[model samples]
Target: MTRAFIFPGQGSQAVGMGQELAKSHSVAREVFQEVDDALGQNLSRLMFEGPIEELTLTENAQPALMAASLAVVRVLEKDGNMDFAKTARFVAGHSLGEYSALTAAGALDLADAARLLKARGLAMQEAVPVGIGAMAALLGLDIGPVEELVAEAQAKSVDGGICVVANDNADGQVVLSGHKEAVEAAIEVAKEKGVKKAMLLPVSAPFHCPLMQPAADVMAEKLTEVVIAPPRVPLVANVTASEVSDPDSIRRLLVEQVTGRVRWRECVLYMGEQGVTELVELGTGKILTGMVRRINREMTGSAVQGSQDIEAFLASL
Candidate 1:
C-alpha cells in the first residue's frame, strides 16, 4: 500500500514520552541530545519527568514534541532500515508538528527546528493577553455551518471582535479561536444550532487565529534567517492542506500557519485523493492517526512510538 508519514502536534505530549525509546536505542537518545544542545537546555529531562504544567508550556511543548517525533524517525531509519525518501509519498503534520514533518522530510535541520519552535511558542504566548483570547471546539457541526456562525458572532460582537475556525479537525469537529467574548458567543450560537458540544479549550492562547498575527510576524523574521531546503518528500502544509515542495513557499506557509486555519481534515482528504492508502504517525501519541481514520475510513493508520512498534513496522514491511 502507498504510505504517508504524519506527525502529531500539541496536546499529544505526556511525561515520559520518548523515554523508553531513548533508553533502548542509541539513535533515539542522540536525537534528544541534539535537541538539548540546540536549545541549550535539558528539555528531554522535562519530557521524561515533567511537572506537567512546565512541560505543557507552549515554548517547551512545541520543540519537545518535535524532538520526540524526530527521535522516532531516527530510530526507524537506523533499526527498521526504512527510507522515507523512497517509501513515503507525502509527509504532513498538525500544528507545530509541521516542523517535525519537515525535519523528517529533510527540509529543516532538527536544531534549527527546535530553536524556531521555541521562539514561535514564546511569541504566540505573548501575542495577546491571556484572558483576552480563547478557543472552543464546536462539535457535531460541519465547516460550512461553523463559518456562518463565526461570521454572525463577529458581526454581533463589539470592538475588534474576531472568532475564526482554528482547526478543521475532522468531520463534525471544528475548533474556534479568537476574543473571549466572541468565542463564548460562538459557543452559545453553536449550542443553539443543535451542536453536540461546544466548550472552551484549556489553551494558553487563541492559536491559529487573527489574534496570533504578532506571532506570525515573529516567525516571518525568524524563518528568514534560517535556511529551508526542499523536502525529500512533498509536505502537505497545515495552512493550504496541499502538497508544497518549494522551499520559499514552505517558509511562507509556515509563517501564515500561525494565524491560518489548520486545514487538517482537508489535508487528509487530499492525501487520500492522491492514493495514499496508509498513514504512519511518528510521535508520542496517535492523535493524527485517529483524525486520519475519521477523515477517510478507507485509509489505514499506524503509529511508531517505541522499539516494539518499530520492530513490528519493519517486520510488516
Candidate 2:
C-alpha cells in the first residue's frame, strides 16, 4: 500500500508524551538528547514529566512536540529499517509539525529543526501581546461559510481589528485568528449563523493569521541561517496543499506559513488524490490521524506515538 508520513502540530502535546518510548528504545533517547543538546535545555524531561502549564507554553511546546515525533521516527528507522524515501509516497505536517516532517525526510538536520522551532515559537509568541489577539474554533461550518463570517466580523471591527481563517482542519472544523475583539466577533457571528459550536481557543497568541506577520518576518531571517536540502520524499506543504521539493520553495513557504492559513483538509485530500492509501502520523497524539479519517475515510490512518504503537506499525510493515 502507498503511504505518507504525517506529523501533528501544537495542542497535541501533553505531559509524559514520549517517556515510554525513550525508556524502551535507546534510539528514541538519542533523538530526545540531540534535541535537548541543540536547545541547551532538558526538553525531554519537560516532555516526560511536565508542569502542564510550562510544557504548554508555545516556545516549549513546539520543539517538544517535534522531539517526540522524531523519537518515533528514529525508532521506526532503526528497528524496522523503514527508509522514508522508498517506503513512503510523501511527507506532510500541520503547522510546526512541518519542521518535524522536514527533519524526518532529511531536508533539515535534526539539530537545525529543533533550533528553528524554538526560534519560531518564541517569535510567534512575541508577535502579539497576550490578550490582544485570540483564536476561536468554529465547528459544523465549512470554509465557505467561515470565510463569509470572517468578512462579516471584519466589517464589524470598528477599531480595525482583523479576523481571518487560520486552520481549515476538516469538513466541519475551522479556526479563526486575529485581534481578540475580531475573533470574538467571529465567534458571535458563527453562533448567529447556527454553527454547531463556536468557542475561543486557549492559545497564547493569534496564530496563522495576519497578526503574525511580525513573527513571519522574524522567521524569514532565521530560515536564511539554516540549510534546507531536498527531502527524500516530497512534502505537501500546509500553506498550498501541494507537493514541494525544491529547497528554495520550501524555505519561502515555511516563512509564509507563519501568517497563512494551514490548509490541512486540502493537504489530506491532495495526498489521497495522489494515491496515498495510508497516513502514518508519527507524533504525540492521534489528532492528525483523526483528521485524516474526517478528510477521507477510505484512507487508512495510523498514529505511532509509543512503543506498542511502534511495534504494531513495524509488524504491519
Candidate 3:
C-alpha cells in the first residue's frame, strides 16, 4: 500500500502534546531541545506544563504544533522504525503544518521551521485588527453553496470590503472570512439556506482570506530569510494540490497560503488518488486523522504523538 505522512495544523495544538514522547525517547526529547534552542526559549516547558491560555495564543500555537509534528517524526525515525525517506510516497500538511511536513521530509531544518512559524504566527495575528475581521464556520453547506453565500454577502459589501470562502475543508464544512459585518451577513444567508451550524470562529484574525494580505507580505519577506532544500519525498503544496520542490515556488506558496483558501479537502483527495491507503497524523491531536476519514472513508487514520501511540503504530507497521 502506498503510504503518505500528513501533519496537523493550528487547531490541533494542545498544551501537553508530545510530552509523553519526550519522556519516553531521548530522540523525541532532542527534537524539543532543538526547537527550544532555535527559538531561544523553553517552548517545551510551556508545552509540557502550560498555563493553558498562554499556549493557546497564536504565536505559541503555531510553533507548538510544528514541534509536536517534528517530535513524532523523530520518534518514527528513532523508535517507530519508519524512515519516511525510505518508504513514504509523499508528504503534505494542512496549513502551518506544511512547514512541519517540509521539515519531516528534510526540505527545511527544524530550527528554521520553528523560527519561521513564530514569525508567521506573529504576522498573522497582526494582520487584521481584532474585532474587525471575522471567520465563520458554515457547516452542512457544500463548498459551492458556501461560495454562493459568500457572493451574496459580497453583493452587499460595505466600505469596499467583502467576505469570501477561506477553507473548503470537508464535504459539508467550509469557513468564510472578511469584515465582521460581512461575515455576519453570510451567516444569516447560510441560515436562511438551512445550514446546520454557521457560527463565528474564535480566532484572533480572519485567516486564509484577502484580509490577511499584510500577513502574506510578511511571510514573503521572512520565507526568503531561510535556506530550504527540496524534500526527500514530494510535498503537496497548500496553494496547489500538486507536488512541488522548487525553493522559489515554495516561498511563493507560503505567501499565498496566508491569504488563500486552504483547499484541505482537495489536498487529501490528491493524496488518496496517489494511492495513499494509510494516513498517519504526526502531531498533538487527531484532527487531521479524523478529516482523512471524512475525505476517504476507506483510508485508515492514526496519530503517533505520544509514546504509547508511537509503540502502537510501530506494532501495526
Candidate 4:
C-alpha cells in the first residue's frame, strides 16, 4: 500500500499534548527543548501545564502543535527506525500542520519551524481587530450552496466587508470567515438554504479569508528571510490541493495560505486518487483522519500521538 503521512492543526492541541512522548523518549524530549531554545521561551512548560487560555492563544497554539507533531516524528526516526523518505509516498498537513509536514519531510529545521509558526500566529492574531471578524461552520451544505449562501450574506452585510468560504473541510462541512456581521448573516442565510446546522466557531480571528490580507503581507516579509529547501516528499498544499516541491513556490503558497481557502477535502481526495491507501496522522488528535474518512472512507487511517501509539505504528511497519 502507498502510505501518506499527515499532520493535524490548531484545534487538535490540548493541555498535555506531547508530555507523555517527552517523558518516554529522549528524542522527543530533545525536540521540545530545541523548539524552546529556538523560540527563546519555555513553550513546553505552557503546553504541558496549561492554564488553557494561555496555551490556546494563537501564538502559543501554532508552535505548540508543530512541536508535538515534530516530537512524534523525531521519535519515529530515532526510536522506531522509520525512514519517511523510503516508506512514505507523500506528506500533508491541515492548515498550520503544513509546517509540521515540511519539518517531518526535512525541508525546515525544527528551530526555524518553531520560530516561523510563532510569527505566523502573532501575525494572524493581529491582522484584524477582535470582535470585528468571525468564523462559523455551515453543515449539511456543499461548496456550491455554501458559496451561494456567502454571496447572499455579503449582499446583506452591514459593513460590506467580504465574507467567504474559508475552509472546505469535507463533503458537507464548510466554514465561513470574514467580517463578524457577515458571518453571522451567513449563518442566518444558511438556515433558509436548508442547512442542517450553522454555528459560530470559537476562534480569536477570522482566518483564511480576505480579511487576513494584513497577515498575509506580514508572512510575505517574514518568510523571505527563511531558507526553504525542497522537501523529501511532496506536500499537498492547502491553497492548491496538489503536491508542491519547488521551494520558491512553496514559499509563495505559505503566504497565500493566510488569505486563501483551505481545500482540505480536495487535498484528501487527491491523495486517494494517487493511491494513498493508508494515511498516518502524526499529532495530538485524529481530526485530520476524520476528515480523510469523510473525503474517502476507502482509505485506511492511523494516528501516532505518544509512546504507545508510536510503538504500535513501528511494530506494524
Clashing pairs in model 1?
Answer: none
Superposed on all Cα atoms, model 2 deviates from the true structure by an RMSD in Å of 0.8
The better-scoring model by lDDT among 2 and 3 is: 2
Q: Kindly list the per-residue Cα lDDT of model 3 for residues 1-317, writing each as its tens digit.
A: 67888898888867688888888889988999999999998999999999878898888889999998888888788776787776678888988989999999998999999999999999999999899999999889889878887888778766657688888888898988888999999899889999999999988899899988998888888888898898899888888988888878888888899998888888888888888898888888887887778778878877777777878877776
Model 1 spans with C-alpha error above 4 angstroms: none
lDDT of 2 at 229: 99
Deviation (Å) of 264 in candidate 4: 0.3
lDDT against true structure, model 1: 0.94
Query: Model 3, clash count?
Result: 0
lDDT of 1 by residue, 32-100 (tens): 999999999999999999988999999999999999999999988876788878889999999999999
lDDT against the true structure, per candidate, is 0.94, 0.94, 0.86, 0.92
Across residues 1-317, which tens digit of lDDT does each residue of candidate 4 receive?
88999999899989998999989999989999999999999999999999889999999999999999999998999888898888798999989999999999988888989999999999999999999999999889999999987888888876777788999999999999988888888899999878999999999999999889989999899889888999999999999999999999999999999999999999989999999898999989998877777789899888989888988888888
Query: Which residue pairs in candidate 3 collide?
Result: none
lDDT of 2: 0.94
Itemize residue pairs with steric clashes in candidate 2.
Answer: none
Better model by TM-score: candidate 3 vs candidate 4: 4
For candidate 4, what is the total of clashing residue pairs?
A: 0
